[model samples]
Target chain A: MKSKCSRENKRKLENKLFKASSLTLTLISFFTVIMIFTILLVQSKPLIMKKPLSEFLTVEWAPHLGKYGLATFMASTLFTTAIAMAISIPPCILTAIYLAEFSTPKVKEYAKSMIDLLAGIPSVVYGLWGVIFIVPIVRDRVAPPISEALGFIPVFSAQNNSGYSVIASGMVLAIMVTPIIVSVSYEVITYVPFEYREASLALGSTKWEAVKKVVLREAAPGIAAAVVLGFCRAFGETMAVLMVAGCVAKTPTSIFDPCYPLTALIANNYGEMLSIPEWVAALSVAGLILMLIVLVFNVVARIVVIRTAGE
Target chain B: MDKRKIEEKIFKYLMISSTAAIIGTLALIIGSVIVKGAAEVSVNTFINDDVALFPGEEHGILHAIIGSLYLAINSTVISFLISFPVAIYSVEYMKKKSLSPALTISIETLMGVPSIVFGMFGLFVFVLVLTRGFTLLAGTLTLALLELPLMERGIEEVVRMVPVSLKEASYALGATTFETIKNIVLKQALPGIVTVSLISFGRGIGEAAPVMLTAGFNPFPPASLLEPAASLPLAVYTYLSAPGQQGKAYASAFTLTIIVLIISLISRYVSKRFTRYVSR
Candidate 1:
């Protein structure tokens, strides 16, 4: 009895140790987000001290003249991502509807993997492809035609004939975010109970009608979450966008204008401008802004997804 | 009714064509890589590390390939250590807690943090004080952090798949939670855990932004963890910028693509096999 009790005690002690270690590790992982925010805040303190936060949000961005306005980069990031989202969302949803409703099981399986393969391709390769393929196509084929036809519209005018432009970055980002949005929307559509579709079909609606009315309606929240996730993805994408975004520090007035994004700004200059203290702080501030926006979108999306799954 | 029928038919075709368009885009990207990169690939491309300076000269990405593998393996190992434990803690200890949702939200948020921000983190934290500069160690740490949320979420998902009944049976047989977790949960989730590790490893290898910031680019191979290193993605970026070196860039991108493809394919195959075994 004594030996057995001691053995039980040993096991208990070991279990306690295991639990403690795992809990410590979990806390460490949890603290990482906090740590990242804190570090960025600390690093940006110098810039925040030199100038008010409002100063950085203005339009001018000549850092050599002590001007560090980030409005141009911010505007470029938003416009590029907006263009990407606008272009990608419709086709992505339609593709998801196809995968979820139209395809045979075997075909769905193959298509699913194909989409997965597309997602698995690295951003840098996408960047390379954008440079080699998409850039020229945009410069020569797409932009000139549109610019000539709609030169009256300020947003359609071609400011430069350079291959590197906002539209090029937007197109690359659209391609990059397609797999993500499609896959997530596909899963969400599939999760809409089949009985709901059956009920809709029983009312004499066609398959497309059932999907458009019942399935998509049921999955709207989850689909919204997926779009938000895709937005986060395209917004924070650095290298691919950097490669095609022209890296110019000017506010773009047209889709064919070369524009710089926040990610590109930080990436293109972080290495070379490390010796300048204020510039480093400005870069840190850039990262902080990126983190905040991504975090908000991510959290909102997660909550929506969790709520939808619960339902 | 006739108009509605016509509309349905049109929409069906639209959906089909849209999907086909997506597939065509994928095909175009992959086809371009293969066509442009295939002719440049040679034995020397994987064996030699020198860059060709003059016309008709040959060079290989031997160093960049090795450096990428080195960083990827080390980062995956580091992330696995933290992620696996946290995954267990989340599923085993925190699942019933009210704070579970918060933890899940945190992890998901972390997942969405940009890879470039991670690079910035590495640059500021590890490069400034820990390693004193851009080193393989700093890059590894950055990549590890970048991958941790993904790995933990993946492992947690698989752990949640372990049937409650089996765990209850273990407990009825007088097993402690730890014993049940070790002998049953881990056993059941091992394949999935391995799959997640491979996926995250593949992802780590492909990320260039974070690694570019943390791991200073070296033309030659790294001699130690403390020194700067080259990576396949960086190689693609650098070689693409050099005049007359587009072929090498394509080759490097092709090689990186192949590595990512192989890893994900293996994981998929293994997971499918594991599921089949479980069904049997």
Candidate 2:
């Protein structure tokens, strides 16, 4: 009776301990989410209520006047991110399709390893390379000719002091986000059943035809979601854009001309956004804008993911 | 033999180029940094400080290196301490299926959060009037905050990969649920959790934003955790951007990159070994 009672007591104590630790972890995870959203909202409130919401729609960012017009920055952020998506998606999808449908096991293994190492490369190193190589090349050679071709626009009509242009930033972002997009798209394509591939081959359709008709069509939503994610990452990115985007606060009418992005603005100024409440107000305002951008992306991404859950 | 073969050849060539592009970029960055930055490595380079306020004298990134490692290790450990328990609770205890999805969403949102936004939160809450000095401790705490979400995500992923069948089998053997998880679930998930931690470790070591504000880039070695000190990332940025120290900055960047690469690689290796051992 004594031994049986002791064993029961041990079981009860163990149960209680396990339950308690599990509860603690679950709470911590929930708390982290609440914390992230709460912080963004709280920090951004100053600009939301006090400042004109339309101020962000303007072309200038004049802090002294309390007008942190994010028109230029928003444009650059969206434009470059859009450009990257455009540049990368076609090739990435093509690569994904080929790998998913056509490539042999040995080749697939080679690509898989390459993709893994690609994801592992850090952003700062990319930033260093960008400044050392990309800026000079764009500024000296590329922009002038592009401007001459599209001479009607006033923005790129005159030569600028630097050529850390919008196109260059876009190019760099495309390169950075390629692996992430390709890998996800590949995963989704391959997840399309072997039956589809076999049916296509048996139907006298070539492998390319099968992938284009069945696999690619099936995985289109997932690919869109992948592109959206890549876009969001490119938009949120700070370090590389900070180094290469020339840190100028101008609006760009031509792709080759540079303008400061929202991320660049926040990164460049936030640490030094001191003394004036207005600067903090502006920080909050920009934060609010960034928050909306991210929220929209997350919602859309969720919708796409849910829509494609089983298909 | 005609158009189709030609198209196939073009497609093959494109795939090859894409693969080369990725492999080439990685090699270029790593190789270039080593070749250029390694040339600037020296004893003084390690010892001297980048005191921009002073004239004609440069200090090595000794203080920053120490500061960074101290903060990164502290923050990583703290984050792991918190996140590992939560991950354990998330997978093992919450076998009640309804609550797990909500937990998963929370984890996903945390990962989606931008680091810049996190910096603002850090500055506003912790750094402002509360922490008077820009110290190593402040940096570590902030880094811990950044690492928390990532660590939880990593651990949770690994824990989930611990099969349900294994859990059932352990219970069938008359082991208590705690014993099953402790011996089987935890053992199985250990590699994955470690992999995630290593990823976070690399990220923390390379972090610049919090350290920019919280650790006020001291040139000399900080006297204690409370004192400000520069880190490798900050030093590289400050040195490279400054007029005369490009070579030193480049070398320091290389050094920091190597440190990050090694930490991540070792953790990954350890995790893999653990996975192999556990499976056996």
Candidate 3:
């Protein structure tokens, strides 16, 4: 009787210990984002103190002259991501619609597997492919034709026909993010109730009309969320973009011009900038900016996705 | 009516063609890697460690393959250790707590943070402060942190799917909450846990940005966690920049791709088995 009682007491003690330990672990996990934000802010404080924050946003980025302007990098980042979205959204949405509404089970299965394979490929491999295949295509085939046909437009004219240009980065990013957008949109589209589709068809509407008016309308917000997620991924991407973006610290005047992005700025300089503390801090500030942008977009996207999923 | 018919036909064809184009792009990407990598990937590519510097010199990526597997396994293990506990606490303890929303948001935010930003964090915390330099420990810790939220979310989803009846049954038999979790919840969630682990491992193996920031390059095989290591993705990146190393780069990419392919297939197989078991 004594032994049994002691054993019971030990089990109860173990349970209490388990609860406390796990709660502590949970709290730590919960605070990681805040920790990261604080670390970035503290590390970048030195740079922020030496020079005003506004100076960092100026057009020049020559660290030697103490000029830390990031406008050019910011513009390039935005341009490339915008181009990626413009290129990817149309076909991604169409593919999602096909998989959800049209494809038979076997075909759907195969398509999903293919998408997973695409998603599974590393960024470096994509960069390799971009260098070998996409770069030449853009340099020789895509950019020259566009430049010749649309030279009047500032964005289309080629100042330099280097294969590593904004278009190359955008094209690589579009391919990289396609699987994400497609999968998310497919899920959202499939979640629309079958009854909604049945009712639309019963009204004697054609299949495309039913889909256009009803299904697309219902899944619009979710699709927007998916696109935002893709945008965040493309913006945050470092290696693949770094490898192909030509890393020239200039604001690109044309899609065929080489430009630097914020990610590339951080990645390209981290190793060599160690001797200069101020430069290191400046890079930290760049990282802080990147984190803030991604965090805001990610939160918005998550909220939309959660709300749609809940409904 | 005539216009509507034509519109429907046009859109149907458009959707089909767009999907075909997407698939074709994927095929071309994979086909290019395979075609190019085949020439450079041989048995020596796995056994030898020295990358050929000059013509007719012997070369291999054995160190990178070994390093990648080491980092992925160690990081996944570390992540699983922390994530499993947090997941259990959330599902079992914090389900009704007001902190649930905060936890969810934190996890999602962590998930959405770019890998590059994580690289910055890893550089700050591990490379600069703790490890004092690029080491396997720094790389592993950084990756573990990156994988933490992903593993937690995946595990939590699976644990929540565990039927309440089993827990109640355990409690009825006088099992403690901890015991119930260990024997009943975890047992039921094994396949899902494995699947998530595999996915996280694959992510760790394929990730280059964070690893590049934390894991300094080493040409030789790592002898200890304190030593710098080579990884396949980073190796690919480095080799691509070398004048005559493009062949090595393609081969490294091919090996990494094959590793990821195998992992995904295994995870799919595990999940399929899980669903079948549940149905039966």
Model 3, C-alpha of A242: deviation from truth (Å)? 0.9
**Every model's TM-score:** 0.96, 0.91, 0.97
Q: Model 3, B155: alpha-carbon shift in Å?
A: 0.7
Instruction: Show model 1 residue runs off by greater than 4 Å.
Output: A1-9, B51-57
lDDT of each residue in A1-311, candidate 1, tens digit only: 99999999998888888888999999988889999999999998888998989998999877667778889999999999999999999999989998999988987888889899999999999999999899999999998899999989999998787989999999999999999899989988888998999999999998889998999999999999999999999999998998899888889999999999999999888876688878888888889999999999989987887777777
CA lDDT of each candidate? 0.90, 0.74, 0.90
Clashing residue pairs in candidate 3 (N, C-alpha, C atoms within 3 angstroms): none
Query: Where is model 2 chain B poorest over a 10-residue stretch in terms of lDDT?
Result: B50-59
DockQ of 3: 0.80
lDDT of 1 by residue, B66-88 (tens): 89999999999999999988998
Off by over 4 Å in 3: B51-57, B278-280
- DockQ, all candidates in order: 0.78, 0.45, 0.80
Tens digits of per-residue lDDT for model 3, A1-311: 99999999999998889989999999898999998888888888888987888988899888887788989999999999999999999999999999999889999999999998898888888888898898999999998899999989998998778899999999999999999999999989988888999999999998888899999999999999999999999999998999999989889999999989999999888898777877888888888888999989989988988887778
Query: What's the count of clashing pairs in each model shown?
Result: 0, 7, 0
TM-scores of chain A, one for each prediction: 0.95, 0.90, 0.97
| Candidate 1 vs candidate 2, TM-score winner | 1
